[model samples]
Target chain A: MTISWMDPHTTSKESRSCIDCHTDPKALGLGAGSLVKIKGSWRLVPATSKSRDRRLNIPRLDGFVDISGKPLVLTSRKDLRPFDAAELKRILDVGQCLICHKDFDDKVMKNWNSLSPPKPCKFFLKTR
Target chain B: MKKRTTYLLVALVTIGLDTDSTASYYLGAKIIMGGNNSVVECNLAKVEVAGSNPVSRSRQFIKTGSHCCPFFVQENFYMHPRRRLLTLAILFFSLAFHSLFPCTAVPPCQAAAVDSPSKVSTTASGQIDMCLSCHDERPDRAHGRKVLGCFSCHLGNPLTGSAKLAHKGMVLNPGELYIVSKTCGQEGCHTDQVKRVKKSLMATNRGIISTLRYYWNESKDHDADLTVEKLLKSDLDTPAIDYYRKLCGTCHLWLKKHTLPGFLAEKGGGCTTCHFYKPGVGKDGKKTNHPMITKHIPMKNCIRCHNRSGRIGIAYKGIYEAEGYGTPFEDGDVSEGQLSDGRYIKRLEPDIHFKKGLICIDCHNQKEIMGDGNEKAHFEEQLEITCTTCHDGRQRLEKIFEEDIKRPKYPLLTNLVKKNGNFFLKGKKDQKLHPLHRFLDTACRHPVHERLACQACHSKWVPQCYGCHVVSDKSKDQLDKLSNKQTPGRWEEFRSFMRYEVPSLGIKKDYKTRQDKVVIIVPG
Candidate 1:
């Protein structure tokens, strides 16, 4: 799972893969920001804090898009991990990209000079 | 909620104490900076005037105070290098900040703004009006309400600050039938809908009129409108039209709104009859926000007027309301407050789909409810969405469809793909994994019954009210000379009516085909 966002539960788990956690609707990238299905039609909750704050920060989870340019919007408070501030900071503090994709620690150095944002999936999967 | 009032601080700087010099000048500047974006420096302490008097100097101020919501200074070129540069930079920054982040916009509980004559919020000044001064705590929902403003639906002058003057011509709710076409159904709004709704059977009472006329020997014609709109327009005496006004008109959405505290009088009209009407529950009315706007027009709203007439909406809930409609206090067998928004628990069993939590929208689409611009004389002419349209195809297959796309629940959702006469729902990827009755494809499905309308078998009940009599009496109210339609005091009333709720059962003949017919319907 991607750790660009500040999430604690994603870091605590020992296993982190691209497909596993990304599949869950609760994951930041999976849900269409602010939209929830209601009786087969799209009912917009304009009052939701995410929509009120304006643009949805959809992070680019796929390599085809740039992460910085497309942050998956943090629309609803439901997107936040159901934990207290203290607990969230603990999970967030210990997290880093190297925790899962550890072999690509060398790739971090290249992001500084790269013209565009790094695509983790393309960088690692293409090599494999 | 304790609201935080952001007060605008206006700093007026006037320079020049020394009055003995060689130039004609009277200079004073007013600068308004919101939040912390812009700052003004007024350091010119001394000046000399050659020729102009203090009275003549007033024109140079430019009179820019009108733009102030709280306060907005007009744009002017500054002679000083530092002042000019500072003013230019501040104007640019303030312009961007003013439009994007409205100074008045904040937490609804903590937002406040002075009624500005210039900048209303950040958009149009006269649009939001001074209504925000009092109801400023209420946040504007983003369904184009900011553009439309409070005056759009609620007829009132938002431009005025005074409570009395502002509400001079205000309508508590734009639900009245006579005014609906110009208000809620006004141009750029639901204009087309109001037009069709005026002509629809619900408005025209075509079904009741046509059926009664046919049964009563008034006419042998099958035209639904013959009983109401046709009679109202004809040169015939008041009895025919009054018959509708007393008995049939009560159920139609076009019925005039009355303020009586009873179950029926307080019922809504026009768009509100289906969308936003509800009776007051308690004396204080604290629990009920009467003019509630909701798109999910609850089933209860439909049953308000319908429960007594055809009872079709009530029948959808499987309620066969009692057969007596008499006594002023009690209208029907269903007690007051029993029909609610959340749930209507009843002994009468509803359709299976209703039990499965399928709402009316599952079958009826936009084109069905709101006409397709091409006006039709009747509602039966509009219904095209059906059951087999979704069930007949390869069905709700997961990931892959063996057949093509067929009848979609909503025909107006034209973006959806339909293949080889049928549309199949995709699985987990698109959330179209609706389970289908695969048994429909088997030989035991009875090919001879294939043409039957789905509701003929599926719908468990149809609410029908019986034994309705018309009452003609001179109305207590004085003459209504304005419209000159109804003579003063002369009108009809409906008080005693009987109802019978029964299960729906019928033999389908030539259903869904060229020779479609579902006759032999006992209204009850």
Candidate 2:
């Protein structure tokens, strides 16, 4: 029997919400940070606290996987590993779209792929 | 001298025991001694004590409807006038005592006492069930009164005239798992099925308990040696076990049906949970027909318990349980879109299969619902049929073996038939022949969708509950479902950010197959 150790990701009340898996960098397997769009591409902005785990070679508290998709933590199961960079980018792109689209019933999302490449949203253009 | 005294003592006790007859005897004596007009009033109760030979005259009164007075009248001939008066006073006192406390007397028969003569019935197995004397309604065609008698399903004394003896070991509902062996599982009837059903995950609740324990970190793996049966025998309190007992215990087959309040009362019998035909009440609010045991299960039976947790039962029917604020108030009042359990819901597009009149049983075969006599670790492992099973790219029904039809795990044979050289599946609920449509060529051949499970795109929306907080308050005591005792450590769950939208995509890799497939994932 495993001892009563709280994996904050699962057991704690402050555990990640369902959306956090798509939006949060840590949940996407890129160590604790915020996803910021620089130029036209998504970039991972690492947290200011630079404390590192020398053993795993990533940030001590937040590192589950690096941006290249190599696992930093010992995964319990072989089948269930963190999202790779490509998979993370696809999910984050949708998360970014959801900021303005709000729901799937939006006309743009109904035939999203049929349309040409999306132009930068009003918020993204303002930030630029 | 001793023999005379013994006879006198017996006569006095007999008068006391038979109160109705003693009352008649007192009235007869009073009419004889007092010469009162009550003789005309109490003519029916008059027990004539002739001045002839007392022994023969008492026998005459018995033939003439004397309640009881033979012994007293026979003894009265030898006793003096004064002693007779004393016996009358004793009889009067006994009559008063019987009237004062009628409940203390031997109870009258309570079983349905038919005014007509007893009806005799012989079953197919050649046993006479006396229950046919009153209850003669034939059940289903299979379990007819002429075939499996009332005693076969309902065990009671079948050879007795007395109602109490006839109903001695009677079971009100024989489908209860506790005493099913003597009824549904008895020697020649449904024995193998009863055995398999008891071991099924629905009955044992093994998978649910083990999976919860694994998620709570109480177990190393999802496959744990925990079951509802074991918990019922002996309780082991951990966070997961406690939470499951308090919340998820009602939907198992081990529960006695109709014990819970409200619509839940119709749920969770061993066999009747799925088999029993639940009749509805008339407009006058009275039962129109008796509930019969049947193989043709209705969708409502599945929906009764499946309407919570996954909420798939209602989701298939286009009912989405909205958050409890009861939004979109009707006429300044709460919304009318509410479930029987009082959960607020909204209308949405139902599943295509449901809109086309397909039911849960049409997709989930008997093996998926009822186990194939194997103890599986999870529901997915036990589930045999998939979307590909029916909607194959090959454009034909899959090969169904003879053994599959015999054991009947693959029930598609019963419903699936070929007509005019075109394959069709008969809908289990609607009894309509639905054409077997193969997968579209474009979708089947698409390279990008190769790893995707059908539900990834086909499933429009899934109910997503976010930030579920389970708090275990040790100070309070909660009712443990397994033990049925108030145990310490109350567990409460709070959920917020409920949304029904396009599901998040996740990859589920089968380690054995080494195939990673994309599937819908919802928050726990």
Candidate 3:
């Protein structure tokens, strides 16, 4: 069965493939379940649980290999292929990349605008 | 020729007769002309003639002459008679003049008797023997034999009754008296008495002198210099030292010789010697016999007669004569027969009161415990021992509250009122009232609980209370028991009462506002 994405606050068009919106470069760093479609039903996951699930799916299999030299996996499933740089950028923009990892947020890392850097944690999570 | 010659001879004889008459008269006149010496000679010659026959001598001389010469010779002879008679009268007159007035030539008979050797020996023997009979009869009586005359020994007006011999017989000079009394009559008479007096506590009065000297040295030099002169001129004329010398010295010297226990001899009683009771009213309304009695009753060991609590029996309420008066009893117990109306009178116990043991020096001695085992000299050192020494009232109460009662948090209040007008209060109290008010209220409210007097709380700083209340080590326990009910709350109540009545009590600052500000701002 195919999943379609929809915005509940607005009457918007739906997509047949989940990758059309979920993998879109502009929607990558947006709300976690904002682009997901589940069997014609559209519901957003809880903010804290969505962020935690997104953290588990770190490697984009459609993109090049990460610094670990292992093949990048774009999907949460184990068997996904790597994608090229143009496709990766189209899938994850600079804004999206910056939001995905704490190190990429120049303003937060440099403490510019008096925003303190995120604190370290035993579990991999950002702390203001 | 014979008649003519006879006549001529008679004329010559007549002339001779006249010449003899003239010569006789001239000698008589010469005798008159002479001073008293010639008068004496004329009188002597007339005396000789008067002793011879006057008429016969005259006639014989006349007949022996010749005719005309006979008449002339007879006349010469007759004139001789008359001249002898005249000489005799003049001699008698001269003797009368000499008898009427005596010259310095001879002394009167009365005067002669005094100058006689027999009289001189008799007068000397009478006066000397009278003095010797009484004074020089014995060897000791003849103290200074070399100077034995009345005038020499006595040396006073003979008219006045105060001649030394008349008054005291023979007073040796001061220097001589000092030597003879000290040496000649040494151990035999008063030497031991003198020694005891010297060692007695009275003799140990050097402390007063030392105190006076210390004051003298510490005072301004000018003021100290005038002390002697002021003391001499003052009504108290005798200096402090002189009082000790006169009152204590002579008696101590006497005690040194006569009394046994030489150390205690000089300590013989003074003012309190005869006046045995303390100076006050006894139960009988009569003045107390001894004026120096103190509050150290238990220490005085007064329990022998009075109750163990030192309370006397009701029978002793009035002045009773000392024990053993009309009774034929011994040991202060009365005989039933001696009692009036067949009633048995209880006799006062013979306790060791002032007469037997208590002496002024025993209490008044300096307060410090001298390391040398001698009594301390300084007042500061001596007064350290107080009523609290023997009485454990406060300590016992505090202990009860702390250990038995289990009130460890109970407050302890120690208040000291100084003579200099300073009050020190240490404890917690409500902020609405002053510390003094709180103290007084606490003290007065529960008088039974805090039975202690104002003097008891204030005595540590103001020692003048001792003038009335005398406490010693032995009496401490009794005093504590008597004051056991005294508690801090009673003192607080007394303070509160004072504050309500007298609002200005204990507010000493110049301005009330200043005190308030200090109290509010200061942490303590």
Candidate 4:
């Protein structure tokens, strides 16, 4: 009898703090990088100079896809995808706001999604 | 004297004696309806005539009971050939129109047999249940031989003496959804529950199939004609459908018990899938007499099939199935972190409910699991409980306590107890009283937090499979669990990467509530 097993996904219980998902580029499927603003545009500064895979010629295994949604792994499903450039920018822009506004009760953080809200962060306007 | 005779007939009807062979059932009804003033009583075990001023021997009829006389009762009656033929014609018409006038007060007559038992073969209702003669194993307290007997759940001809005749239409497992109406859904039994469970998502599997078919571009929308019940009937084959039949079909309630191989054989026996519990032998190696069939379902029952797919079952208990590298060999030996089904797992922090030892049924009530007789399309639509329902202390705590009161008791849900003029929900499994704290309004009253689902912030992590490649080989044959036959096409899936991390966030627009909520999204 041939004994085989299959379960592609499982989870641990240690939860992510606010900064782990919001600020970290690797956590958001953008690879290991530091987010910085250069000339009114957000640019990812690579943390490590890693070599590409010789066989597939794709990015390293740790990363799923780049900020532009160009897949590093072979994804056959149209529904299963990584964050696109616009989505990545939107998430990182919030990360900038979170740096100054640590607490959720902050007036600027409370009305972040509202239309005529307080703009406390100078970095948010640069991305917009 | 005539009034005494009328009372005996009324007592016979009230006891629900199936005296159709004695012809008293129809005669008693006819006499009661006609309001006959004349006293009439049959001779005990003999065909004797009764005159208009019949002797007050109606007490003897009551004393002799169901095994009384087989005489036709009429004014100046005798055992004549033409009179017997007329009685037979009346019997035929009564049988035809019996349901029109329902016997509201009468209990359903238990199946009975002739040959008087020398040893053991009689139910509590004084009926000869021939099933107990051969298969007389002691059942649980709730479904004792004296109470339900063997004939209640397992429908068969219990009146017959011959084994062949008795076993003619015997159902092996009455919990199977197709024949549940004849067994569990019997008039005075769980008729309403059976009706509701048939429409439940667990039996129908509407949401799972619809989402899969929609993702595969086979359907325009997620609400399509794809359900487990529909799939079992049709022989249609598509890429997504074929994959679903071979893989995902084992979890639903329609799957027959003992049909599949290995661990799968234990899954999906309708009501018994969740409710059946077989106790182990005594510590002294003595065999236990009974197996419990109860509403108090354990965590192991829910986790049997729920360990796969979403992996919510395992996740609740802090067990994570990890990659197969034997993971950081300790003490000069590979760690034995394998499941009985041959999967390697690592320990993680369990859910808050699991840490406190609350079982699945403590929060999830009958309505959420069995459904409310509505044909819902998804699990979210079927599920009624939320974090707010329990912890928020504002929404559904009172309703949850009321639902728990209805369950059968041996081991009661001690969680929902009133202590010192205060209602507190203790953990059913752990027996520890958990404090229900309302959401802290100091930090939670922000506008951004208003539209956020609890799981968006609180859920630790979700399992992520980046690229899952499923390859189906048409040359090989594989066993279909639903059909129980080996058909063409063997399928296998290989995942490129697996990771556990913070789930991606997405907007869920609830059209019914008119609320735009941010919820955690796990990519399929």
Chain B TM-score against the true chain B, each candidate: 0.56, 0.72, 0.18, 0.74
What lDDT is reached at residue B464 by model 3? 8
> What lDDT does candidate 1 reach at residue B436?
43
Q: Tell me the lDDT of model 3 at B192.
A: 40
Candidate 4 wrongly placed segments (more than 4 Å): A1-16, A25-34, A43-91, A104-118, A121-128, B1-120, B281-286, B325-336, B394-421, B511-514
- lDDT at position B269, candidate 1: 61
lDDT of 1 by residue, B117-166 (tens): 33232112112234544542221232122333455556665544446545
Per-residue accuracy of model 2 over B1-524 as CA lDDT, tens digit each: 12222333345556543222222213223323233332233342333434322223334433332344333333321223454465545434433443353432233423323342233333422234556666756566566554555766787655444466467678878888888987888655677788888878888888678767776778887677777777877747677878998778888888888676666577788788888884565334555454578777788888888787667888888777787777664576665578877889878777777887888787777766878888776566676777666667334474643334565644644676667866677898898988767665444434434666666556666675544557888999977655556878888877645766535444567433668876555555
Q: Write the per-residue lDDT of candidate 4 for residues B1-524, one digit (tens) a residue.
A: 12222433444455453333322212422332222221134323321112111111232322333343333221112323443344333333332333344333333322222342333243432233557777755656556554455766686655444465456568887888988887777655678989999899989888778767766778776667567888889987888888888888899999988789987888988888888777765333546555557778988999998887567888788776665554543575544487667777767667777776678888787888899898987666666666667565634556656665775431123355666645666775666776766665544455545766666556675665544557889999988877888999998877655556655554455434756665544435
lDDT of 4 at B457: 59
Query: Candidate 2, which CAPRI tier?
Result: incorrect
The C-alpha stretches of model 2 lying farther than 4 A from their native spots are A1-82, A90-128, B1-119, B280-289, B329-336, B394-413, B510-514
lDDT of 1 by residue, A5-112 (tens): 110100110222222222222121222223233442222222212223337442222211111223222211112112223322222221223344432224443232
In model 1 chain A, the worst 10-residue window by lDDT is: A4-13
Which stretch of 10 consecutive residues in model 4 chain B shows the poorest summed lDDT?
A: B47-56
Docking class of 4: incorrect
TM-score of candidate 2 on Cα atoms, chains taken together: 0.65
Best first by lDDT, ranked: 4, 2, 1, 3
Q: DockQ of each candidate's interface versus the true one?
A: 0.01, 0.05, 0.00, 0.15
Q: Between candidates 1 and 4, which one is better according to lDDT?
A: 4
Worst 10 residues of 4 chain A by lDDT: A1-10
The native-contact fraction of candidate 4 is 0.09
Q: After superposing candidate 1, which stretches have Cα over 4 Å from the reference?
A: A1-128, B1-128, B135-147, B175-177, B224-240, B256-261, B277-290, B323-346, B374-378, B395-434, B438-447, B459-512, B516-520
